[model samples]
Target: ILRETETDVLVSYLPVGAEEATKWYVEQALTAGCAFVNCIPVFIGREPYWRKRFAQAGLPIIGDDIKSQVGATIVHRMLARLFQERGVRLERTSQLNVGGNMDFYNMLERERLESKKISKTNAVTSMLDHELDPSDIHVGPSDYVPWLSDRKFCHIRMEGRTFGDVPLNLELKLEVWDSPNSAGVVIDAIRCCKLAMDRGLSGALIAPSAYFMKAPPVQYKDDKAHRMVEKFIADLMRMDPDTARKVLNNEITAEQAVQIFERLDPETARGVIKAGIFNVEGLTPIRGAAKVAREFGVDYGKFTEEENTYLRGLMFLFYAWTRQNTPNWFRYITRNPGGFLAKFLAPWFAVVLWNNTIDEELEQSLPPWKRDQLHLITGYKDEDGKDIIIYFRGAPFVDALE
Candidate 1:
């Protein structure tokens, strides 16, 4: 179909957590010289390995879950932000969504809903600067009622305390047509990918993915991401498609491209994009290397290019797991930097400084599933969809790696 139609982009509106099917589509897009926009919860854009692949292939990509314009997750995120800004201590919150479409029916199996649950829960919790306990927040599809036929009903409850120890609570019930809720957002995502292709840009589109998807490769505050998207479209609109491509290929040098994006002020960088001063002719996405380093708060100027890339990959991997497992630790590191194991103290150089520190330290401390594996897959019961465990006291580990 792609060869016959000359399709340059592939949009996966596949059902949530369709990992096996999505993996095939990913390969197909790469083989076909096509961009990919994923609208499901199974991760791709957020994964370092795949993001690097798409970038290396010079293909634009966005994912991992598309967000509805006015759905439960978005609403809950806004409320969470509101509570924070207003000096209210948000204690706990939960969102329950029920829909009657086949989308909902497929999700009735609890085991199949892991990614969906994580996507929704993260969308809300990310709004607050403080840590939200896993036990205190719940967000996911609750049940399916066939008679309602494509309509979704969401219940959101928030419990918080305001200044002076006063209790505050909010309860909201949202109803919308499930099928059409995300259509507009997906359409906009399609246009953005086309724009990236036209401008000779590839890899993860950091801004559009944040505003339009639940699990962007880089998560920005919703308002900031929205502003960036607006600026992105407005800036790109000033250049003709062919001229944009020409500028990308001919007008920019790699050094200037990295400086214009990674070192320049945000406003200046957008102006450069608008003025057609930056391009990825020799550079690529996450822009081959620099953008990833800068965006993730690393200063890689002193490091060699290869060292920078390797370090960025490590940071990216660390962030991917930290986003789910140890958000508090992640927050601590990002916010205060010097609070790990020996606060107000230092590792003794005299005690033992060996090359073994790198491998020996992490290998012993991190869980086997995390340290030794590249990917982890869990099985689901055929009847009810609850998770299935596969670990044993002395089992081989190769199967877990895949």
Candidate 2:
């Protein structure tokens, strides 16, 4: 039927006891060139052998166990994460589910239930950072009430200790239509498979599987899984072959493609840089400011007349006191380093000390006579090697002056 219909995806929701048969069906689908979406608890997608075969065949596969849109397992996992994040040590947890679906009836055979139990148990326990004793966690199908046909009821309980050894616990019940609870998830998984096929992608799709299945090939945190799925979909939808080719050929970057698509002009680009709206090569703000200034034909190191006067006044104050009573001030500071006089002199000393240290370091690094020639030039320089006065200037302040 898959080959005749030319199906894009084959969704498998086979019965619980048909694990062996399901494997055969998956193989059949792959052979028929149909993308597979396993909506049952079988290891076909997660198992290495099947994954390798599917990759070799160049067909996308998703699954292990289907996840309901709002299921007992998801709820339990979220609550467990909540407890751990809030610093509550979860001492015990359990999720009991009762349903009247064919699935529930099949699970009546305990032999067919081991995989389901493991999948559901791991779904919750994986969210916890600490180890849990096998005895402390209970997660599996409980009973089948035929009259309730397709209705599932779930009871979840969590017991934990908070600050001061205070006891806290949460208990909740959820009632849902068993089959339809997962129907939406199956539809989404099928669509993801179709999307992968459209993109000429094969093998296991990590994001969709992680978001939609209980036992994905690779597990991810719920939020991260959600984000990955979002990105996957966005990438699929936004991918332009021409743009992608250009990016691959080094004609433009992915970011530049986005900017071009947004119709960004040079003026707006400059504004974005000046407004600190973009990160350039992981440059620090000071260095970034210098780069921007150079791009805009501005002097990064050019101090205003007012700033020069202030700096000159500070220099004069330091020189006057040092020339008049150097020995006495040095002795006072040494005796009472935390004193107001010492505190007052500290900033001036720091500036001169740092300047001299930088000068000495530069001189030592350079050849002997070149150091003297280099000392003839002070302040900063542009890329063109023109001398420019260097001063600290905030972008907002510069903008205000403009």
State the weakest 10-residue window (summed lDDT) of model 1.
348-357
The pairs that clash in candidate 1 are 111-385, 284-287, 284-288
- Per-residue lDDT tens digits for candidate 2, residues 49-130, read 8888887887889988999999998888889999989999999998999988888998889899888888888888899999
lDDT (10s digit) by residue, model 1, range 358-392: 33543343223334433222111223532221111
Deviation in angstroms for 399 in model 1? Answer: 64
* Candidate 2 to truth, TM: 0.62
Q: lDDT for every model?
A: 0.66, 0.65
Q: Once superposed on the true structure, which residue ranges of model 1 sit more than 4 Å away at CA?
A: 240-402
Root-mean-square deviation of every model: 20.3, 17.0
